[model samples]
Target: MLVMHTPPQHHIVILGAGFGGLRTALELEKRRARLKDFHVTLIDKRSEHVYTPLLYEVSTGALHDNQKFCVGELCSGVAVPLEAYPQAMRSKRLTFKRGEVTGIDPKKKEVHLKDGTRISYDDLVVALGSAVSTFGIPGVNEHALFMKCLADAFRVRQRLAEFLGAYVEGKEKRVEIVVGGAGPTGTETAAELGNFFDRLVKNGIIKRKDYEIRLVEAAPDILGIYPEKFRVHARARLETIGVILMTNTKILEVKKKQVVTDKGEINADVMIWSGGIRPLDVVKTFGLALDEKGWIPVEPSVLVKGQKDIWAIGDVAAFLDPKTGKRVPALAQATTKEASVVAENVTRRLERKRPMAFHPPSHWVTAIPLGGAYGLVDFGSWSLRGRLGYFVRKAADFFYFFSILPFGQAFRMWLKGTNVYIKND
Candidate 1:
């Protein structure tokens, strides 16, 4: 008699528990029964996960700091809720290990962690997001503040607070703050700072005429990628709030209290670098097929080229637009859509089925808040401003947090009268 032996269970390992990782984990839980033949493990270097899109609000104190919750806490509850149906869910697993991944051996199908642990897997997902790219500019990394992470946001707030306190205590009659970049992040940050300073002045903490806020952009106008209507309205709103707009200005260098631009040098007590972001250095170590700028090169389905059973998503993965042949913009909407597609692909691949294709086109939407009772919303063709836009923006922010937080906890927080305001410790 001949006997057939069952194959060893498949293992799915995911790296970087950002939006992509969290969404994938939740999808896996929903498909637990069918995925019993496989084990899923999610790995991330950080203990907590933050929604990067709303980070600017945190920096500007529009939302409370506590709004960002740790990823581990979020996942643990999710895993438990799906504990039933053990027979159908043989290997549903999630692991949160805080260690940097050093290298990947595609030949052996294993990942080398910095802590000397070798994790073998049948399939792998790379969702590690990009880091701030200084473009080899001088004094950017060391001097200018970034808004990438929670710590970075808090640091910016602290720095701003310190500068304000120092100005109030000293005899200096003038204060200047320069924001580098006019993208969504930089523009939003500059607007918030402008409002913050205005409040301080009105509250007698500082004098209105003594503060100067300048928003510098290398392009001809702010909100370069946004629609023209948005650009016009945003610039107008910013100017109305007493923000000095400087377009077509290239930053040459950043000094302790001055910003050297191509046109001329400007004195500034605070300089923020919100220019751009590049792939993390760790991607280089993988030696994967990468774009000219070091971002992972992937196919339409978000799979790494020339590497089977390996995939990439989020800002770290560069997908070409089929129509224009240009790289897709790194936006939260794009990343979330990619995550959903990746989850579906993973499930199909495990079931010996074909993966779905990902086709993303350029789109435009905005909800830029210009401080209290003011905001601008541009939905590609139409624009709205003032109170209606402000409420829409607030609701949008609330919905993002509401979707992520567990239903019960979210409802409890709501019942407790927390109005989407995250307080920082």
Candidate 2:
């Protein structure tokens, strides 16, 4: 006798557990009782979810001693009802049982996992996010360390700690730290390391003159995304903290212990590459309409062109800017806003209503922590510096991470933040 398995009723499958995916899942749950019709399945390769914006602090040892647990606990509240399955998105209903995404079929909407299990989804949401893009630069992937995840942050911290230990042990050893690209990640990492080195110096672990820190960028100046005045202020602040600024230098190659650039070669004990980001490789497997750079081309509504029932957000989605006619930068603010729109659109689709249009916000705020208790804040037209800027930056950071959680949970996080240094010590 032949038998057919009945599919589970009210299924909603969300791929990735990043900001976009997590937010979408939460919003769906918020409307779950009203909709009364969908089982949500949240899939990610890793069990832990991290707040990427504050990852640099983790690397500097300013956040937590145990970085592993910090990331896993960030999403503990949301993981309950969403069923956080540690799996990769291979296809529509098919996923790699373990942590690998082997194959996907967009046409038939089937995913094939490495362990030979398949899953079919009634409704699919892909928010797999982007990965560190090497930009076809040779030796980059093999040599330069990335700060994309908790593991990456931990690895960088471990390396930094080891380097410090070695420097303290051997007086003659000269350690050079090279940070490539002067974007927010690179800038923040440089600043945090500067503070860490300052702390080491103050603690007599190492002399201030023992370490050499270099911030390199191909652009004319650091903080290229921000206005020129803000860039000037940031550069000045970084220089004051002993970071050697090297602008207008293009990296030709990244060697095992050195970087070859248009200007010259610099030997480095630690190399961090925060140059740019590319779309996730899995996006290619979906066979969706993509731009020349492999980013999914989407309409104003954040829907993938030529692909119905599919949506893209975050760094992976390439939606044209109505004003500049250029692609928007893949910032956390952009991703979070896009997530809300995606969730609302999905709800509209279920109700057979028109989807809302995606509009880039007019004003955006960027807070960049220089080191320890100093930073720069840019509110489009206005900019703040020094202690005031630092206060705003810290407040913004707290708000951004805390607001994502429930009210009580947010309050707990606030309390934890207030006493994080004491507890860690």
Candidate 3:
């Protein structure tokens, strides 16, 4: 007589369809085919995932269609159906549920959704992500536009279009666009807007003297997290494209038509906020162990502290870098890397094996596109700028796309018409 053993099925619930959660589910789906004991369920509010890295480009006319950026279509372009992935095709246990996650009960291992339904899980992955932080600045939330989502990007394009149209029609003599914060999002957006205006002026649509672009930072210098060499290089590039740098100037308030700063007031037609971020509201209420900043504390295995089966990844999770003594950044690169670690650890635990610890990289790469066909790239010790840097950034964008999309689709989309640079007349 021969005896056989059957593996027990496990219910895995992943919250949020952002990069970290989605990647973890996909990675687990691959392993479940062999393990044959786990069913994965992914939940999110939106139907599509927004590719945030390209949002600045979409906001500017440089990457648009029909003279505007379509918020719905832009999100749909990047959003792939969670159920349509190859792993999902082979695994009937993989599924996607569209709903807003309201709360969680760790004692019962149940997740509550706004729809009044409850989901139970043997293992849970909480990649709830982060939200924009206005820092309680007076009039910011009410007046200033954000650049966090596809909808925000679309609103930016629409507002810019209206402002520029008025300027061209002679109703406005000067148009000023102020971008608050000197981080990558702010700097890139400022430079892109400068390039857009330069094209309009060269094409005789608007006079070069009729518009002003400002990049404001409360910090002493822009790109402060980067090396001094890269920061100076980035600053010079912005200046070359006619963006006025306002460093060490804090914003006091945002009025109806102007912004009051510590130094002076800026007359503005548009204002964009890309200042900082905080964990989502749900994360704050989840009762997870969080740091003073309210981000979930996670162990080196990417598991939420004090929780055996719950893992937290992405912006909502804070893992301190032992080497730098700083929390890992909320960049897309970090999200993907952390997702991989969590996925592996989850599998190892299922097999009764010791979970592996995550090691932060010694150094990271930074590639930024200034504006037009110009940009900068820093590869740890080495650096490059100008056209070469621009191409390098494009290559990195394509590489990320490749990781998420089918090869043919990624290649075609990367080379799409939206990416083509229009020559300035």
Among the numbered candidates, top TM-score falls to 3
Off by over 4 Å in 2: 1-8, 62-99, 414-425
lDDT of 2 at 13: 60
* Each prediction's TM-score versus the true structure: 0.87, 0.87, 0.92
Residue 114 Cα positional deviation in candidate 3, in Å, after optimal superposition: 1.2
Clashing pairs in 2: 10-39, 93-119, 93-120, 94-111, 94-119, 96-113
Superposed by TM-score, candidate 1 places the C-alpha of residue 11 at a distance from the truth, in angstroms, of: 1.7
Write one digit per residue (lDDT tens) for candidate 2, span 1-425: 11112453555666776777777776676665554555666666765556676677656644323343353343232222223222221123222122445455566555555565555555566777888977777888999888888778778877876775566568347678899999999998888777777676776677776888999999998988799889989988888778998999998899998999999999977899999888777778777778998998888878888876777788888978888787877887888888888878777777788989888876668888888778788888889998898788767756765645555655665555434422221
On residues 112-139, what C-alpha lDDT tens digit does candidate 3 reach at each position? 8888888888889998788988788898
Ten-residue segment with the worst summed lDDT in candidate 2? 88-97
Question: What ranges in model 1 sit over 4 Å off?
Answer: 1-7, 62-92, 171-173, 361-364, 411-425
Sliding window of 10 residues with minimal summed lDDT for model 1: 77-86
Model 3: weakest 10-residue lDDT segment is 416-425
